[model samples]
Target chain A: MKFTKGRLLEKAKEISTPRARRMSMTINKTDFRKSMKKLVDSEGFKHLSTITGIDVGPKIELIYHLTRENLVLSLKVKTSKKNPVLPSIVNLIPGAVLYEREVHDLLGVTFKGNLDLSPLLLPDGWPSDVYPMRKEWAPQDIRKAMEKP
Target chain B: MATRIPFGPQHPALKEPINFMCEVSDEKVLSVRPRLGYIHRGVEKLAENRTYNQNLYLIERICGICAFAHVTCFSQAVEEILNIEIPSRAKYIRTILAEMERIQNHFLWLGDVGHEMGFNTLFMYSWRDRELVLQLIENISGKRVNYAMNTIGGVRRDITSMIMPSLKEGLNHLEERAKYYTEMCTKDPTVLRRTVGVGMLSPSDALELCAVGPTIRASGIPRDVRADDPYAAYEEIPFKVITYDGRDVASRLMVRLDEVLESISIIRYALDNLPNGDVRVRVPRRVPKGEAVSLVEAPRGEDLHYVRADGTEKPVRVKVRAPTLANIPTLCKMLIGENIADIPVVIAGIDPCIACAERLVFVDTATRKRWMWNKQELRKYATKWYRKK
Candidate 1:
């Protein structure tokens, strides 16, 4: 079965406040699980493309890129920098295991149920608690730490 | 008791650094765990610091083999935010370069699989043909590897009539070789023993794992970025999405081989019906505040880039999701319950580019020792062993 963006977004709104735009849809973090559930059930967004973790000011924004056929849907979820914790959707979408671990490694957001939050892309001996993707970890800070005896 | 074999962050079978810890009993793999981040350069974080134009070069470096795919995906995302319509000629040229890259990448993967399977004759023959495509690419873009041909609005160079004659000749030669290779892959018994029904992935498992590119397609699902979501000149250009239900290494080889034939036709069609117009348009440094997602069908699978601009010279964020990242979990799924000896062929079937997917490693700075084991208990065991020694 084929679906237009409007039809997909309409089904998506049942679980969350998904305001559909030109080519994509944006959703709130609060309704993330519900919206994702709805999309998977009705919108055919079974394929988890990739997750993008960005350090936006006070929060780390995680964008879940999901696709079904030609239609692409990106669900934006944000967690505060001070206490970054989000529900792990690995049970719902198993393919997200590596991506979630990668976000945790770089941005320090914990995906609660993800059994292995060990570093996905950071080097060994990279200091604990230093999230390189975070805005606070400046270039000079990394250089200083690397050169330290 | 199951014996654990830690196969390569560096191994003879693996071309790049990625660790796979498998528990085997009676030579069959009980389970497999993949450890990534052996070469994480933090390319995503670095993109935030550089301007849109300058980052083009950096993004291309993400994968040496799939360099053009990265540039095209990045440029398309940036162009979407700016809402600039690239010239028709530019679209055709972009499509041409993309197909050329696909040919080189597939042939390279085929050759690598041959090397892994101890068929050096296939490897030599495939790479010999690959060199022809690389030469044709060099003829057009003037650079073999990182053809910095794609820019924001359009492309850096135009495809001229002077290059068409030789380019067509090159494609014709490649077609003949592709036919020969296709016949060999089907008829060859040694290839059959290594690939046929070795690593099985059901369609349901593939979709659940969210595998992309040819890996998923080999499982009997026709999910292709180009066919599903038309990018560049894909809508105007015609091509078939190749799929095989063999659900094993053999299916993957056949799918890739078939795609090479399709790519030849697509490139030939684009060149023969080449549109005439300017190749590039001047894009402003400061892009408007907006977010855009661009998906390109790279040789491996889907190449995706997400761009966010806050009315600045440098982008607020640029997120890249290479295909190998999406397919890694599927590879893990295939590895489980398979013979340990099938590891190399199964992994090679995915045509994984670990350099593009991985980023970091675990190291104990105090002891100056790398974390060989993923679990804390295993790390503890290693520490105790070291202390005893």
Candidate 2:
């Protein structure tokens, strides 16, 4: 019943590109935490639906889907593949802890401030460096890594 | 001394495999750490290799109870990327099957919860009623557990008028039973004793933790994705977003019970207004380079599916965020400050769909003594503990 006015869209323009749609915005990796804070505190984007971390050739794209009533704003941030590290939003939104760990487990992206980056959905003795979701890991590669030394 | 209890990877309460290491002093829980991924099949990575339609079947397998929800959300996301508008009748049929799945799933959870609380009478009756509901679903889709009715473009099957009579009859029966169960759950002293004030998640905590479905709704959120985002025929179908302010195990029970009735009404509305047209549209295998996120209000909560197609037969990436995973943090939060005897009821509060539930091995920190209890033993201990109270 409660749909926010364009306040989030307005605030999103501060750090994102002009190509921002009504439901999504592409923000620079540097302004990721700031934009997430502004949206959560100012525009009522408190409910983080889920975080989708995808490997995009040279970069890893992390989309934080924030929902308030009917409005779902996809806040997309791109971090380099070589050094995929981003500020942890668990401080701002504590619910993101497991999701951050899931991303860390599969994509090898690091959430700087999230102390508990333990493997969420992987075997206990699974290799630390091998993230199966990355494009380089084939079906056979995942199986090979899981094989006991 | 702070003793530790490792709850599961083979939990006896919720019948699921996931571990929770709880630090407790005597019977009082201090902190809980959840270790998941026991059943992790790597479906997300698997989805990237398979074609759009192949991914449809794979995603649904993510959850046995809410299989159709995953398929619906996955198919809808792929349809969005293809920019294909499915027929109106397809939308109506999708809603019907979805609500049917919700009805069946809630009944399963109801039976499971009753079993968890040492109340086999409620469990037996609820499971009996659940079978009839499953028959209605099987009659339409020919398969009960993982109904492959949904395809990329639309649903693969249609609900003809010939099947309407049986569907209506089944729903009428479910409605009566649902109302009775609702009344019994609200008034029953034993149910009240086990559920009331157990697993308390405040409105702010729920919203902050991003709790979904009946879990958050029970906390008085009223944030159902069906009403909010308006997927399938939900925008046209009228229904109430059930909410309860109790914010405990009882409130969660009441929310689901009321929602079962709401879902029945939704099914009735969709069936009455079932439109006439083709059920599905033929589409190309290769989707255009695009991305979309689909959210469905499954029986447990909001089920999410995100798809990014790279102009190929296989998708670039597919992400599934099941409702149970979303509520784990809240589950961990609720486990704290509760008696060890009340562990099963609290874990079963969120209606977790897994292999085993209610297994706890207690380890004394100072003396280094360890002991274990199975699901039945734990349930019996809870009964005796409550009897003493």
Candidate 3:
């Protein structure tokens, strides 16, 4: 009942592997959404604290952080930059709206079905085209771009 | 008639720079949209470039009041990644510092909450008593704001026998003062009239919104990071998790006051059982390639830090999630259908760190104006423009 970090990761690996190749179970996008809903409703991982997005080379990896008891289940979902989109978990975890909005604004990832997709952190008129965290966008260059009328 | 009022990035009562676009009809708040990110320093991006040790100081600067909690969470994440066992003595000291911070921070909030409610006597008394805890922290860390006492593995300062007596005396004084403030606030009819039954967040709403700290506790949830996770010396200490079922501003105040008493008890217990050993253990400069999360009970609520390192001096990724961020959505929800006059009091009930919660820009659809202006434009248009000129 006391969930250590090791035990939680082991559970995730057990659920992910066995049925799939490439060492981990890469659930299809539809299956991933269904599994996430099931986890929240049945498993009691109700609190969605944050959704972290990390750009890994060709794909952007999204980690959905959920907590139940002392265990944090990070559901990892990866999508390519060319078509970076994921089903919005806002309806299941209403608290995730701000965090989801943050990921959308900062990383330029599209969260499908997000009602309030307006900028969460960046000001309006901040070049809609520029994402600050990307490698190609330098801080000085962003500032210069913002200044251009 | 319906109208929208703009509460600012520079309001008098708002301690930090944040703007709120509030829609009101018949002097009642219909809804409020918070416009933030005015003070965002790009801390996450900065953390990516700085060494793990350097980020310690940077994280501390995230919020001046919650500096210790931030660095402690950051250090714990690094320690977890490196598989370092902090000395038992170091853990005890860290707990003591954290409790000390909780004590002073609650006192500060007590003062601010009283001020927001127009109770100047309570404000003056609470702040006057708060200096004792601040002085205790200064004695241990040599500074008031950023302690610089926490390292990756453990604490830099040790609690010596000579300072033990002084700490006890300070706690005794604080306990007496806190009792007096609690009595005055709890008994005062005006305070009750203003705070009680105002900005009520039901338990279901709180759970759905994932409100943390005293906010959730006010709604009758018994989740405390210190109690649940048992980080540092918290497992060794004895303390009760405080909760109130009223789910109102009064309930929130009661929870904080009760926790202040508990914090005193924790500090006394930590000092009595203080162990003798090295304050800090040496940790490797480059942590192993791993990701870890550490949660701490900050004065506000649950403070979480997620860290990822790639066996380098710098952390590959660092995400700082303050309790204020978790509580904001709930606070915004409560603002709906409430009288406009009570807006400040309701907002203060959550005890937000404007610096932390205001991490997003608000866009005005009606005006078609972008709220996320660059620093240069801010300098050109905001009050700072006149000052600079």
Indicate which candidate wins on lDDT: 2
Once fitted onto the true fold, the runs of candidate 1 whose alpha carbons sit more than 4 angstroms away are A1-23, A146-149, B11-15, B354-389
Query: CAPRI band of model 2?
Result: medium
Sort order, TM-score high to low: 2, 1, 3
lDDT-best of 1 and 3: 1
Residue B75's lDDT in candidate 3: 95
Candidate 3: C-alpha RMSD to true structure equals: 7.0
Model 1: CAPRI class: medium
Best by TM-score: 2
Q: Model 3: residues >4 Å from true position, as ranges?
A: A2-28, B11-13, B354-389
lDDT of 3: 0.79
- Could you give candidate 1's per-residue lDDT for residues B1-389 as a string of tens digits? 46666655753333468877777675577777888887677788788899999999999999999999999999988988898989989999999999999999999999988866667799999999999999999999999999999999999998889999999999999999999999999999879877899789999999998898999999989989888888789989989999999999999999999999999999999999888889989999998998888888899999899999999999988888899888888998898887655666787889995321111233333454544432223324423443453
- Measured on C-alpha atoms, candidate 2 has an lDDT of 0.86
Local accuracy of candidate 1 as per-residue lDDT tens digits, A1-149: 35554665443332332222224556666777777788788767787888888898998888888877655777777788899998888887899999999888888999888998877777777787788888888766876876675
Cα shift from native, residue B271, model 3 (Å): 0.3
Residue-wise C-alpha lDDT for candidate 2, range B1-389, written one tens digit per residue:
89898877763334468888989887788998999988788899888889887888888888888999999999988888888889999999999988988888888888878877888899899999999988999999999889899998888889988999999999999999999999999899979988999988899888889899888898998888898888899989999999999999999899999989999999999999998989999999999998888889888898888888889999998999989999989888888898887777788888777523456787888989989887677778878988998
Worst 10 residues of 3 chain B by lDDT: B354-363
Taking the tens digit of each residue's C-alpha lDDT, what string does model 3 give over B75-128? 988988898889999999999999889988898888877766666688798898
